[model samples]
Target: MIRPSSLIFAAALGALAGCATTSAPRSGAAVAPYRDSIDLAGRIAINYSRDGKRESLSGKFTWRQSKANTDVSLISPTGQTVAVINVTPSSATLKQSGKEARTAPDLDSLTTQTLGWTLPVSGLRDWLQGYATAVDGKRFVATPANDSVVTRDGWKLDYVSWQDDAAAVPQPKRIDVTRIALGQQVDEMAIRIVIDPVAQ
Candidate 1:
């Protein structure tokens, strides 16, 4: 069964574009590390299945991230605030309307325990910016010709579009992420993120 927290967190945090195929490693320039701080407003869509029932959710989101912490707000199509999530290096918190806030020592554990899935916040922070840290500890950068990367933590990321095709290092406009089910208990999940052109 899909939990409400799963749907909420999926919309709050943030990709799948093409066939869930792995990308061959190719020569490319390294992408610069993500900035220390950013305020991004965008939309997110998620699709997953459980108990043989398929479900989907789409919502708007705003992400305010800094080196020390991050804040995310999930909004409904009618502009109502669905949930608020705050994350720090040591802890994470999630609050839904009229309910007690849920807290955990960290995001990975938090989502896994409460939402029944791994949100992979750490890896996602980089994937959202068109880069990834592979299991080997090497960084992979996204380029027009070579835009797909399989992350170290088990997610496949496809850089579907770029902010500026001509820029030396293009920012990701749309990122599609997919994770195949690890076991019968885990469902395959796909999330699509469309970042707005201008940062708020």
Candidate 2:
């Protein structure tokens, strides 16, 4: 049987997949890395651990974003779909394998209710662009290079490496994220994304 955490992880993966943007930076000019939106397809490996228990899932993902709507799909290693998540300004829905569709007022609430954990869905778009989304009462810090460590909202994101696509702006290749609570580490996740070369 698939573990609940695995389902949650898959849903979270789906949520992240929804943040990809389709727009590319112009050539031969410096441009801001973050775009208003994006669409992307790639592979993702998620590792989740809490209090010595750990779960890992690796699969393919697709994310499309337009204005306030985002759609994400997570596929298992065996080429079967695991989950699909749809997010909008007011609601989020998750459709899992062999399960009834679940909905909540937002992605965070939906994941918390169905997956028993909350993912940073609101900030993922910014995180995907190598930046942090601002939250009230939260402090965000970034490296001077803007390509390294980013800490915010009790999460520490390490930009391990970047992918250089010819004729396109380089994008993040590997990222490691850790969740902290009360000054102690509680959970961690890693994501490696390969932007579809043909999509650019």
> Highest lDDT: which candidate?
1
Model 1 residue 55 lDDT?
A: 74
Model 2 over residues 102-181: C-alpha lDDT tens digits?
Answer: 88887778877876677755466656665653333332323324444334466656666656523245566566666656
Position 154, candidate 2: lDDT: 61
Query: Model 1 compared with the native: what TM-score?
Result: 0.81
Candidate 1's residue-wise lDDT over 1-200, tens digit each? Answer: 33484444443372111111123333656454556577888888877765677777888888877777778888877788887888876878777777778787777666766657665435666666666766465667787777876666677778899888787777789988777345122454678889998733
* Leading candidate by TM-score: 1
Displacement of residue 17 (Cα, Å) in model 1 is 22
Which pairs of residues collide in candidate 2? 20-38, 20-39, 21-38, 21-39, 22-38, 22-39
Residue 169 lDDT in model 2? 51
List candidate 2 segments past 4 Å from native: 1-3, 15-33, 50-52, 134-144, 165-168, 181-185, 188-198
- Model 2 TM-score? 0.75
